[model samples]
Target: MDHIFSPWRYAYVTSRKGDDGCVLCGIGAAAPSSDEESLVVARGDQAFVVLNLYPYNSGHLMVVPYRHASHLGDLDAAVLAEMGRLAARAEAVLVEVYRPDGVNLGMNLGKAAGAGIEDHLHLHVVPRWIADTNFMTVAGETRVLPEGLRETWRKLRGRF
Candidate 1:
């Protein structure tokens, strides 16, 4: 069998930083100058778009409000509206940059609902294509991405 290597994921899979603080909140609080390192592509008044560190696809992004809110109902109308706007912008940018066959927008609300970060509510904007999932994901329990995060951030940063 041929081996598919993704050495970058080693840091993610082995890191204990998830115990330090809320990752989303940390990214939200980071300075604008650090956006590239943080994988943040766009910022708005209420929400910002950042590429997923462990993405389902090349351009998988999350639109997160700066505030730490566990649930959607906890947010005010303006924040909610801005999150929606950011998600829309993310979709447009993903289409323009990746030419995806389709896109998936979703939110995993809590630990029971598949949220990796349960305390911070964020909307996911995932670029999808036909046959994007293959045997590697099912048989090997791994995902193969054609591009890296920095490249994805570079391609999407200016569009948003």
Candidate 2:
């Protein structure tokens, strides 16, 4: 066991904002014309797909329902169904645009479960390559994403 440092994360760890009013709610409330500013790649009637501000990989995305719900059980059937559909669409878009070796899809239900915005439930779609997790992560505890979020948004937005 050795020590690895990521001093860049100090500000994030200490200054992280609390989930007061849901971030998803703010994104959902944003006008469609401002989708790019919100990092939204796709917009559906019930749900939408946006890039994760803190991404695991270049094409990391989240499928979130417009309805601000904390838990899966809190969402209605329509929202739940649309969330699944949007997640699938997001994966498809990522595959076509990124061509990653694999994809990870999941949901963190609460703060203790690693949900940054625990008040608004969202599904994560992270793209994974064969060697995506390399020495940087193992030795340095850092992730290197080759692409920027705005660029990723541009690549996937039209595909949706």
List the global CA lDDT of all models: 0.76, 0.74
Provide the lDDT at 83 for model 2: 87
Which residue segments of model 2 deviate by more than 4 Å? 1-20, 135-142
Badly placed stretches (over 4 Å) of model 1 are 1-20, 135-142
lDDT of 2: 0.74
- State the displacement of the C-alpha of residue 157, model 1, in Å, after optimal TM-score superposition: 0.3
- Record all residue pairs in model 2 with backbone atoms less than 3 Å apart, i.e. clashing: none
lDDT of 1 by residue, 88-142 (tens): 8888888988898999888877666677777887887888888776522633434
**Which ten contiguous residues of candidate 2 have the minimum total lDDT?**
1-10
C-alpha RMSD (angstroms) for model 2 = 5.0
Superposed by TM-score, candidate 2 places the C-alpha of residue 80 at a distance from the truth, in angstroms, of 0.9
Name the best candidate (by TM-score): 1
On residues 1-160, what C-alpha lDDT tens digit does candidate 2 reach at each position?
0111111121232332224455677777778898887888888999999887767778888898888788888888998899888888888888998898998888777655666777787888888788765723532534566777788888888797
Report the CA-based lDDT of candidate 1 relative to the real structure. Answer: 0.76
Candidate no. 1 TM-score: 0.84
